[model samples]
Structures are given as C-alpha cells and as structure tokens.
Target: MVLMQAEKTAIGSICFLAGPFTLLENALVLGVIAATATLRRRPTYLFIASIALADVFASCFFTTSFLDFHLFRQSDGPTAYLFKLGGVTMAFTSSVGSLLLTALDRYLCIHQASSYKVLLTRRRALLCLLILWSVTIFISFLPLMGWRCPTGLIPPCSRLFPYVNHGYLACWTSFTLVLLTLILCAYALILLKAHRHETSMTSLQGAAGTGHARMRMDIRLARTFGLILLILVGCWLPALSFMLADVFVILTHTQQRAFAFCSTLCLVNSAVNPLLYALRCRELRVALLQLLQRLCVIGRCKKTTQDLPPGIHFTEEISCTAITEHEIPTNGTMQLHSVSEMVNN
Candidate 1:
C-alpha cells in the first residue's frame, strides 16, 4: 500500500516530465484543427479534436492529483479527492469514447464511402460528442454521488478505495475492454474489406490503376490502425487488467507499484495520439506548420497587423489560397487524401 521514497520519486518524476509534454502535444493538435477552417467542418477532425481536448484535461488533472496524492500527500477532504479522480475519469473516458467514434468514422469511410458524409454530418458528430461527454461526466462522478466505500470495516478498500467505488471501477473496466474489442473488430473488418477490394481489382481488367491507388490508401490506413491498436493494447490493457484483478484480490505493494507504472503508461498514449492521428495527415501537418509560422511572425513583429511587412501579408494570402485550393482526391469509390480525410469529402 505504501510506496518507498525512491519509488514515489520515480513515479512523480515521470508524471512531472510527461504531463506538460502531453498537454502541449494535444493542445497543438487542437490549435491546428481550430485554425484550419477546412478541417473544422469535417466529422473526422471533430472526433480528433474531441480526443485532444479530453487528453488536455486528462494530462492536467491526472498529473496534478496523482502527484498530490502520491508524492506531495496533500491533506484533502474526501470530496476534493473524489472530484480530482472524477475529472481524471471523465477526461480519460471521453478520450476512449472519442477514439471509438473515430474508428467508426474510418469504418464508414471505407465501407460506405458514397454516404459517409451523409451518415456522419457535422451536426450529428457534435451531438454524439455532446452525449459522450454527458454520459462520461455522469459515470465518472458516481463515486462522489454516494458510491464511495462503505463505512470502513477492517482493511481499507483497494487501490482507489475509500474514494472510488469498486463496483464503478469494475463497470468502467468492462466498458473499456468492450471499447478496445470493438476497435479491434472494426479494424479487422476494414482490413478484410480492403483485401477483398484489392483482390477484385486485380482480377478485373482495366481497373488496375484506380484500384491500386485505393488499395494503397487502405494499406496505409491499416498500418496506422495497426500502430494505434498496438499502442492502445500496450498502454491500457495492463492497467485495466490490474484494476480488474484489484477488484477481486487485494494487490500487494509490488503490484500496486506496477499499477502506478501502468497508469503512467496510459498517459503516454495521450501524448502519442496526435502523432498517430493528426500529424500523420499531410493537411494537418501543413496547418500546424502554418500555425507555428504565424505565431512566430506575430512574436517577431511588435507592430500592429496594418504595420506588418507586405511580404508577410503576401505569404499569409498564399498560404490561405493554398489551403483553400487543396482538393480531396476522389478516385474509384474511395475519396481519401490522407489518414484523417475521412469526412472531408
């Protein structure tokens, strides 16, 4: 139950270092999406933006509360502790939900290319996000709403005991496991469908060029999804398994330390998500670069916008025009330009 001084320092140091980096990475993803009007209108980017926003909160709340509880040992009331954990729970739950929605978006893009846009309109995407966050908030705060540990018996409750309810943890763990399984199945079907398309194209005469292009897109998407699955399983499965175990058996000190490490690994996923989903897209990369460049220009120029150099104005105009002129490639039945261009068409 108690971590050694060295163990505490080690875990705290990792959280301290990784927390800001995670926050900054996700924040940049959000900034790029917000700055790019073209990306803002699509359901895909909206899901991605939702993930980044949740990660931003996750990084902030988890790092602060974790350090407070484990390292600093802040003397806080039960209500305050529950609030911190609820925030962490809500943020992480929303993140996982958004990821599931993103996978569904990709599935529709591949399987229902013709009606992907109609199926997932921007308004509908926003509504899904609203409902996801609403449900996540309610579920996360159940412990605070009279679901805490019963009036203390002998040995205290498990890991998140006395603050978070065991039943809630079990249910949440089951939900996460279900989400991971669904994501795996979704990607499996996508790959299978792509394989069928490739085989059909190869057998057909005069459709090689277009079919090959679409196949290449599918393969690239498969690779990206593979990486995502790898990370998700690597980062989450251990912690989730541990939590599930904790629900049944009281974990030893060593197991507790391992769980702590696993929890930190989960935070690493938040940092890497932008790389897998956002920066991999050429459009988002360009937008991020332009956003950084604009920030640099603004930092260097002390004068007002009207007093800026004409060349800077010209550069801005050209960048704007370039972004506006960029077109989604529509070849065969697939109209994807990049990994994150699912709903852009």
Candidate 2:
C-alpha cells in the first residue's frame, strides 16, 4: 500500500511539472504566429491558432487536476468533482473539437478550391470556433444536473459508480468515435483529390507546371494533417479503449496505473502540435527563427532575408527574373550598334 501511494505521488509530481512546460511551449508558438503579420493574415493559420489556444487551456486544466489532488491535498469533494468533470473533460473535448475544425478547414480548401476563400471566410471560421466552445461547454456541464455521484456515494469522490462513470464514458466515446470517423473520411477525400490532380496535370501544358506546384502544396499540407491525425489517434485511442473497458470490467490496481499513464499520454498530445508546426511548415519555421533572432538566442546581429515567407520571396523572384529577361540587353555589340545608328540618323 505504501509503495502504491508512492508510485501515485511520483506520477502526480511528473504531471505537475509537465503542465507548466507544456503551457509555455504552446504559448510561445501562439506568440510567434500572432506576432507575424503574414501568419496572422492567412485563413488556415486561424485554425492552427485555435488549436494552440485549446492546447493552452488543456495544459492549464490538466495542471490544475494534479495540483488540486496532490500538492493541495484536497479531498474528493466539490473541488475534485470540478476538476474531474469540469477541467479534464472540457479540455479534452475542446482540443478534439478544434482538430475536427481543422480537418473540416482542410476539406473545404480541397473541396472548394475555386471558391474556398468565399466558403471559409474569416467570419465563418471564427463562428465555427465559437460554436465548438459553446457546444463543449454545454456538454461538459450536463453531469452537474444529475449525472454526478449519487447521494450515497458522496464524499471520497466515487469515480467508480456505474452511472457516473458510464455517463462520462458514453458521451466522450461517442463524440470521439464520430469525430475520428469524419476526420478519416475527410483525409481520404483529400488524398483522392490530390491523386486525381496529379494524374490530370501530366497531360496539360503551361498549366501543368502550375498544377504541379499546386500538387506539391497539397501534398505538404496533407502530410502535416496526416501526422496530426496519427498523433491524435496514437495518444488517445489506447486510453479511450481502456476507459471503454472499465465500463464492462473492473480495472485492477495495475490496470488503474496503466489508465493514468495513458491519460497522461493524451495530455501530451496538446504539447506536440506546436512542435509539428515548427517541423513541417516553412513559414512557421522562418517566423520562429526570426523570433529567436530578435530574442538574441541565435547571436546574430543582422536579420536573415531568407527567413521571409514563401509568397514574398516568390514575388521577388518573379520580378527579378522578368527584369533580367526583358529589360537588360544581352549583347554589348548590339546595344552599341543601335545607339550608333540612332546617333548617325
């Protein structure tokens, strides 16, 4: 019993430390995205920023769970119920909902390429985010009405009751399963469209070059989303599976620890997203680099021009190439001949 208590304490301590770290890392990512005018203007980045915000909330909520239970030594009363029902559930749901929104955003980009801008306007995106928050808040509070511990099971915070446990489990599992399915289907359609575009581009002419450029862009975006999906599943599925099992079969002491470990893994997902952006998105990478430079972390006196967003560099490159190709005379003799003829005339 003593050993078991010690193990639980160690785990709580680890989670407590991890919570602040996760919040800091995600906050920095948000700061970089918000500080960069280029990133803030892009519609897709709005969804990314929303995810970061959710992550920040998640870190705060999860951290509070550990602190309330361990360091504060709070009994399983109102505070415990608040953290369990309010903090963890709400945070997890919000993060999952944000990912669904992101997948939907990507789908709209691929589905309505001609008028994606019109379809996914800034107004609509913000509205979607607001809806997610409203819906999650509604669901998270449902248990407060009656789905909580029964009067008899009160005090000591009985999380093991069939009614309360299954109530939470059913809601989460259904939401998770539905979102997981939709995301999978969305990515499937995205992949199919990209493949078709690739095949059609092979037969075209000047447009083929641009088509290929679009294809590369699509592939890169798809890869990043795919990684997000994989990470989400890898982290949450095992823990969710265990939760579902707990509904039918009682978990042993060892199984309880496994559940805790898996739950911690799910929280870790919130932190990884910023790292993914830094790794996969060139614009984000450059923005982060510029941010670090300004902070004197890189020890560089001059800012690097190569760290500009791709669109800016693309325009500059095209303008420079146009000038070089049309404005400058390639042959010195021809230039001299034309000038001399004009002078003689």
TM-score of each: 0.82, 0.72
Candidate No. with top lDDT = 1
Residue 312 lDDT in model 1? 37
Candidate 1 C-alpha error for residue 24, in Å:
0.7
Cα lDDT tens digits, model 1, 1-345, are 356899898998889898999999999899889988999999999999999999999999999988887788786777887788889989888888888999899889989999988999999999999999999999889888987875431234556444566677799899989988998988888888888877777677557487668778777867877888999889999999998998888878789888888899888888888888788889899888888887876665444445643433333322222332234233311322321243232
Model 1 score (lDDT) = 0.81
Q: How many Å off is the CA of 309 in candidate 2? A: 41
- Compose the digit string of candidate 2's lDDT tens values, residues 8-112: 677677677768777998788789888999888776777788778878888988777655654465557643565475656777788777777777877788789
Candidate 2: clashing residue pairs, number: 0
Q: Where is model 1 poorest over a 10-residue stretch in terms of lDDT?
A: 331-340
Decoy 2 TM-score against native: 0.72
Off by over 4 Å in 2: 1-6, 13-17, 67-73, 151-165, 203-226, 292-345
